[model samples]
Target: MDAQAAAPEQNEVPTGAKQQQAQRPAEDLVWIDTPGIGQRGGIIIKDLRLSIKNGEFVYLIGKTGSGKSTLLRLLYGDVPLTAGVGRVAGFDLRRLDEESIPYLRRRLGIVFQDFQLLSDRNVYQNLAFVLRATGWRDETKIKERILEVLRNVGMQGTQDKFTYELSGGEQQRIAVARALLNEPELIIADEPTGNLDPNTSAEILRLLLDINHRQGTAVVMATHDYTMILKFPSRTVKIDGGTLHEVQKKTAEPSDRAKE
Candidate 1:
């Protein structure tokens, strides 16, 4: 592995910083404590503690099978919280029942590795389906919201196109548009750029950063692409040894030119 890709030092976040975090509970959009998360007959991670503040952008990096995806699933209510205290976007994961899962999900935006666009539907229809399912009854309002999100992701004119007709970058942009439909407080992305080339991945990452900067939506992303991180530095955590640890990179501050 390249030096930049090597695992970051564990437990490098200062204790005082951690203390400051505890004092600001109201700012955390996602909080977990000693969380027991996994499928039936098994738990992938144990005693995991995490707190993501409002409007912050963080990266989750780890090797394959390191419980990164499980953590993301737990946040979005896909996996049941078998043990421990958990909260996300104001919903308690420990108490989330099937009936309340949709309500919890509406407050979050989830992006998957593969663009999970409905193949039978065009971009407009795909977005409209979510709005309608989420109790968006007014067609005019739904169309306006869809158009706004599309424009935000820079995919405004492609609404009439099918998923197959769009490029991977464009499809991912649409996926992002779908995520933005609810104006979610947090966006949980799982290996969102895994399917794209480096250039395309850069585009998608930039788009996400723009959203984070402009909309003040908290973002937690899991990725294996360290180069992208090197290009766009932010608070990062690594999943290793069945635990999550903050990664303290020694890189210099990114130049404004790099951000542009």
Candidate 2:
């Protein structure tokens, strides 16, 4: 599907306290309060409050089926907010509709545990396809953007390669590159390294950190890799029993991990 296609727009008013909270500055890429979200009439998470500031890197951790994925979906507008005040990438979550989804998405980039590249197309073709679908008419600009993103992810010369031909690590890098094509304000990564080896996972982590540092792109990454958390400590948030809580970092531990 074309990630940039326009959707319908709507606005919803939060009640009482939530309405007051929603009136605050929307500087953060994502802001929510006691939000209830789910799919198909089932509430996966409730009373979840969270905020992610610009250029911040937050690790979302939890056991399997603890609502990590559902929360990520909520941020990207895949799952509708059942109740509460929420805003993401300048769009009010409560007000989100089909017409505003694409605009909301354009301000953010999403990465998945599974690489969602087009198997039949070469790397360049895959990216070009997205750009074309999004209304890019200038061939020169499209090629430049593809090459720029590829360079950012260290996949500069692999544009001619097909998706099936690249290793898992390489494919993930391409995926990251694809996510960067629009220079999104926030990057929502859901277990982006889940399928890669340890070393490759570390490489992906380093790449993401580098992007966060250099481009000032805020990142909210849902992960199960506690080892990565220990290796590259940052602000950690845990989801349990359908609620979100900030995990305090251990003090008095000295290591080489970078600080946010």
Task: Name the candidate that leads on lDDT.
Answer: 1
Residues 1-260, candidate 2: write the lDDT tens digits: 12222211112222432332234364677889855778899877777889888888889999999989989999888988868888886677887777667666767788999989999999999988877655566777788888888988999999999988999999999989988876788999999999999999989988888888778788889998999888888889998888789895442111234332
lDDT of 1 by residue, 205-256 (tens): 9888888887788889999999998888888999888888889534333233
Q: Could you tell me which residue pairs clash in candidate 1?
A: none
Model 1 stretches astray by more than 4 angstroms = 1-24, 249-258
The CA lDDT at 201 in model 1 is: 94
Local distance difference test scores for all models: 0.80, 0.79
TM-score of each prediction: 0.87, 0.87
Residue pairs with backbone atoms closer than 3 Å in model 2 (clashes): 7-98, 7-99, 8-98, 8-99
